[model samples]
Target chain A: MNETSAALEVRNIHKRFGGLEVLRGIDLRAGSGDVITLIGSSGSGKSTLLRCINLLEPPNEGEIIFDGESLALRRARDGTLVAADQQQITRLRAGVGFVFQNFNLWPHMTILENVIEAPRQVLGYSRDRAIADAESLLEKVGLADKRDGYPAFLSGGQQQRAAIARTLAMHPRVILFDEPTSALDPELVTEVLAVIRDLAEEGRTMLIVTHEMRFARDVSTQVVFLHEGRIEEQGPPSKVFESPESPRCREFLASHL
Target chain B: MRWSVILENLPQLLHGAWLTLELVLVSGVLGLAIAVPMAIVRCSRFASVRAFPWVYIYFFRGTPLLVQIFLVYYGLGQSPWVRDSLLWPVLSQAYWCAIIAFTFNTSAYTAEILRGAIQAVPEGEVEAARALGMGRVVTWRRIVLPRAFRIALPAYSNEVILMLKGSALASTITLLDLTGMARTIIARTYTPLEIFLAAGVLYVLITFLILGGFRLVERRLNRHLRPRTGH
Candidate 1:
């Protein structure tokens, strides 16, 4: 829960989409084996901060340090910070897995192909090695039978689990979940969350942005409450959920919880 | 409409059909080979990278195929610098000139078709590729281009059919393609109706075959989209 064992640390992230400032000076950290859940209402910048960790939506200002290495950064013409080395950013991204709200599985590829593609192409693993890694990961996520199926054929929950397996195939140091169950039908949400719960129980490092209050409270070691593009409060899940100091945090959590 | 005249010239007509098929097939492959890369360049992020290809595609798609043939054939051959250059050997031959014109023309149309298809790829799917750490080239080859090809297939088949017909212009440039061979036989035997009809029949046949080939490709590329026939 502290900085000493931090696997991923993002300091003072600021992101602007045109005139709209989405994330303003947010600092987040994930230590080894920690499950940090980000809870906020829609438009509170939870998703944007999750995306900024991998620089998928590059923060205009921030220092991202992954695996104890600081990301090489440079100032853009508009005074926004950008990754100085594209290769480095890509390399770092491989170390951080991301699961989206929409699954976003490659429709043209089978689940097995989708999972194996990154390890093979990005990490330059041999075909047999990648397939072995993918098969085992798929088995872990209970998607072993669905390996040959396409994304469209599977239900939303199944696809999200497969997406998780796809992320795990690379053995990434930390995984980011951006509302993994938000797109699922209410009945289907439990299966995907159960899969995520299993990952959390296994002591995997994760940062989750979610709307599911009970799941967050149950699974998270730490909870961060974001309000209008800034961190209203963050601490142990019990403290933030029960005795939040920030009135905004208490108001938002009470509304959702 | 003497059947005798048609029968007598059938052998010569077949030879001309063979030439037409060669022209269409080779250029179809060559043009697409050039087009895939050109389309990727056409859709680049940098305006500077986008501009030159824009002009290349514009000029080809803008002018008539006949004019393009002439530009490569007579226009280039006539230029003193071109005549004196290393390309003169290929430029001097009508066969190569026709191929050049058709290749360039089709490459432009194909590139434009693929550009639209590439852009039409779902933004989230591409974003997923980025988040996976696949580099630009790897993402394009493994994710973008294959998906684009699936979307581009129908429009691209239309381009191929148009190319088949436009290839009749090859005869106008002094190559003995299907139309050209038909004209030569008609001149000899004075049988325009039979000769023209035969050539038209052949063109329709090729069109049917092209459509069939595309259908097979579509089935293979889109097998994932089809519902499971019970596992």
Candidate 2:
């Protein structure tokens, strides 16, 4: 894809926690409408990379360019590349939606309220407008009837879907899923994946960190294999999954799949 | 003791009971106002912001309420600096001294209770709020504080009831609250058991009222979590 068409670009990102290096000089590019699946072992830093993209965990060193804007390198008063300010980082974050592995719905709020809160508070949308938008998103996720239900009252899969709707309500340009189905029971995984598949079909730009190899192969346009804090191999799903060029990718996929 | 004497002195006991209830109400409200903010500060990321309440809680929770009252009333009176200060006008009154002591003591315990509650708010919820692009202040106000208050409610109610009992300490500072009035009545009539029992019964009634109020608040907070029957 052309540089201008790419929704997110990560260049030489490095992240460390104390003595451990989690992400080591990772470079990636994802275009609009691309569904990229990041598959890796537990300590492979796929989730960390996704978090860095949203500034949830700021990278130790990196450049993240989103929508033609340099998110990592901020323009100083003298027009040089400095660190991004809090306001700039927050504006960048608002454009990206995130769904956690554990389905982090606000247990105290009703599903409808959870969906509407960000729009009303962050996006500065009118309460009425936020409610209307939340309702539509909830309907799309098949959760319109569960509007007043609390997260505790909903099943795990249902809560994850509601969380997706909550993210969608903000009208984010890209959505990141960090093992969104990993916390679900085996039987419930399909339901959550179904909602996600629908999102993929609708051409929502997505980066998913998941272990479900079959789903990743079927749904993703590109699949990246992260091994020991580096991208071992990445390509279109057919080439990566069916005919992986790297032995490390083959070993990783063999163990997981 | 004769039932008639008990019946006759009941009006005096009720008057004292009213004063006791007023003291508790005033102190409990003021104590919570101080405690909630103090708790937030104690949990703050900055060490400087967190230190003052830590010292306050350590001082009050470590010492007896009686000692605090004595220190506020007698100790402050003994200090030449305090005597010369503008604060002396407020400190000179026994009622103000009692209020100040009760406010300080209860606030320490309440702050600890609220800090535990705030900590009990799941890390996941805070992360979710942050991912939603909520600023720190908005996240705390809308999500963290409300939920933390709910989690802290039972403990806070217990503290309120404890403060109600603690207010009896105010009588030591020479405030003519319930226990003080009871002491006066005992001195005049030489009926200690009769007066003390009356005060005890009034306290029990107030405890019941606080328990009922807490139940109402708990129900309102948990309404969303309750299961629906018809659907």
Candidate 3:
């Protein structure tokens, strides 16, 4: 309910598949430079909430507010809430960049091309300008030399970094990390986590869904525990990680940590 | 049985091969033009949108090319309606009719091949493009179609070669293509063996050249898949 500082807000998100509900009503907010990390057991809908925030998966109910504008919504004939304006949805997606767990970089394009594609195509940036910015972003992620290589040629950790660079190329106001390190090998996890830590130090507003309990505790300003598709507990990392309120949250943390 | 007859008729046979190349080249390009959009539509997510293209692909693929040629050439010629239509001039010529038939015929096959390739594009990549804010058209243009074409290059090369051999059927429609020239030389010289053998040689050579051309193109498109040289 604190509207003054919140950069992104989601209210009462309810989602369902054909027969099962994935997310019950959930409310959370991240002010500027806030790092909110969601942690829970596998089927607890940790990932679904992030998907709904960007309209990658529209919630059956609830609205997402980004940059102070609520997405225009209307009811369909079948009566599910859908985005009424496609352009607005696209604009919102561009502003809210997402890093997938699988590192879904387009395999056909080289690393540099992958990094520059959305900027040139979606943002209508000139090719040279996009390339220059992409090169720098890649360099920022310590991937300047691999820019010419294909995604298949890179390691999983390297690919994840490139994906982060790709998302950063869009220059989004808020970046969502959906289990970004889950797909990485154990040894490579540290490399990707290190890059994300640097971003955290730079005052980036990020919503991360991660299983690395230690990294999550160290990086996040607010820690949210999801259980059965609902926010069971949410607070500062010190309080939630050390002395949690809900028994389920504590049990889940004990099992993961 | 005179082996010298093939040597003497080489010029005429070469001219016939030239016409055959023209038919395949024009129709193949036209077919591709039709197939690109058709394939895109063929893979539409909605069953309703896929209905028409599915039937069209089925009809062309289910029937033989010879029959398709006859339907366009003889069947259309029989209709007084077609004769009076604006397309009659182009339709009246066997050459144009053969091109039209071949274009439609190959387009169906090419579209089907491309549809499979497009569908084979990784579902994750499409979602990735969407997540990056790419519109459907831009995604198809930049990500989907280009990647699909890469995956499709080998199968498409096979289709082109088949079209080359299929162009021999053009002779049945009274066009003096490669096979047509062979039949003509047989009639005049009464030496079917030498003339047919000579024509077969030309077809094989053309097929070889087509294979090489596609190999080079495939290499260029698939350079990323291969290990980078100069290491």
Candidate 4:
């Protein structure tokens, strides 16, 4: 891909927790309208890699470039990459939205409040404008009637949809999902995946770490297989799932399927 | 047993009851202020910030409130430097000393209660706030502290009632609080049972008022969690 066409680029990213190396020398790139699905075993660093994209867990080494800006790279007085300040990283994070495994909705807030909070507080939208935008987004996610309810009162699927609405309200360029359906009951998983499918249809760029093999195969434009902190194989889902080139990918798919 | 005797001493008991209410009000407000910051420090990530309140809470909570009152009233009074210091003007007064002792004693317990509540706030909520790009101060104001205070409220109300009962210790410092007035009446009239029973009634009334106030606050704060009528 050309340098200007890439929406997100991870170059030689490494993350470690003391003795444990969670991600090792990982590199990836996604185009503006691409839906990249990462599939792997439980501790293969798929979620950790997604979190690193937002600087939620800063990588121990390497750089993450979003759009044309370097998210993990700091420019010096002479305009060179060094170490980014935490403040700049936080500002960069505003450009990316994340959906957690457990549908981390703010329980204290109404569904409407949860949707509008980031827009009003982070983006400095006025109350009237934020509410207007939030209502439309809630309607988009099919939660317009549940706007006044607390998250606890909602089903798992409903909460996940509300979470999607909350993230979309921020108008983030890239949305990340960390196993968005893992915590849901088997029956509820389809509804959450359906919302994700709708987001993909709208040409919203997405990076998802998930265990749902069929959802990945059906929805992903690209699929990455991660094993033991490394990308074992990756390509179009038709290629990766149907004809995984690597022995590790074959083993992983065999175990899961 | 005479109704006339009870009526004659009613004025003195009422005055003391007023003093007891004053003590509880002053100490409860001061205690909450001290507790919130103390609890924040107690749960801090840094070793020093965490250690400071750990010691403060341990000493204050480990010791009996009665002993703490005696130590402040008598032990500090025995110090020549304390007696001569500029602070002596305030500390020398029995009322101020009692307030200081009660405030400190209740603060230690309240801080622990608050710390548990603050810690009990789900990790997901904090993560959600951070993801919203809220600064530490705004997140604390909008999310953390409010929820923490809500969780701590029940325990705090119990502490307030305990502090009201604890105000009885103020009588030991020669303050003419409710229990002090009751003691005086008992000594003069030699009707310990009748006079103390009258004082007990006043305390029950005050406790009920406090309970009512907390119920109102709890209902308002938890309104969001209540089920909606139409939905």
- The models' CA-based lDDT, in order, is 0.91, 0.87, 0.92, 0.87
Candidate 4 on A114-159: residue-level lDDT in tens?
8888888878899999999999998988899999998888999999
When 3 and 4 are scored with DockQ, the better candidate is: 3
lDDT of 2 by residue, B1-231 (tens): 745555777778777778888888887888889998999999998898899999999999999999999988999999899999999999998888888888888889999999999999988788888887888898999998898988998988998898888888878877767788788878888888877887788889989998999999999997766566747
What value does the lDDT take at residue A20 in candidate 4? 90
Per-candidate TM vs. native? 0.96, 0.94, 0.96, 0.91
Whole-model alpha-carbon lDDT for candidate 3: 0.92
Of the candidates numbered 3 and 4, which has the greater lDDT value? 3
Where does candidate 1 clash, by residue pair?
none
Off by over 4 Å in 4: A72-84, A255-257, B1-8, B74-89, B224-231
lDDT tens digits, residues B1-231, model 1? Answer: 587887888888888888888888888899999999999999988999999889999999999999999899889887899999998888899999999999999999999999999999999999999999998889999999999999999999999999999999988888999999999888888889988988888889889988999999999998888566766
Q: What DockQ does each candidate score versus the true complex, computed on alpha carbons? A: 0.78, 0.59, 0.68, 0.47
Q: Per-residue alpha-carbon lDDT of model 3 for B161-221, expressed as tens digits?
A: 9999999999999999999999999999999989999999999988888889889988888
Model 3, A1-257: lDDT tens per residue?
A: 46777789999999887678999999989899999999999989989999988877778899889889899888765555778888988888899989999999999899999999999999999999999999999989999999999998899999999999999999998999999999999999999999999999999999999999999999999999999999999999999999999999999888888
Pairs clashing within candidate 2:
none
Per-residue C-alpha lDDT of model 1 across residues A105-136, encoded as one tens digit per residue? 99999999999999999999999999999899
Best by lDDT: 3
Question: Which 10 successive residues of model 4 chain A have the least lDDT summed?
Answer: A74-83
Candidates sorted on DockQ, descending = 1, 3, 2, 4
Ranking by TM-score: 3, 1, 2, 4
* 1 against 2, candidate with superior TM-score: 1
Worst 10 residues of 1 chain B by lDDT: B222-231
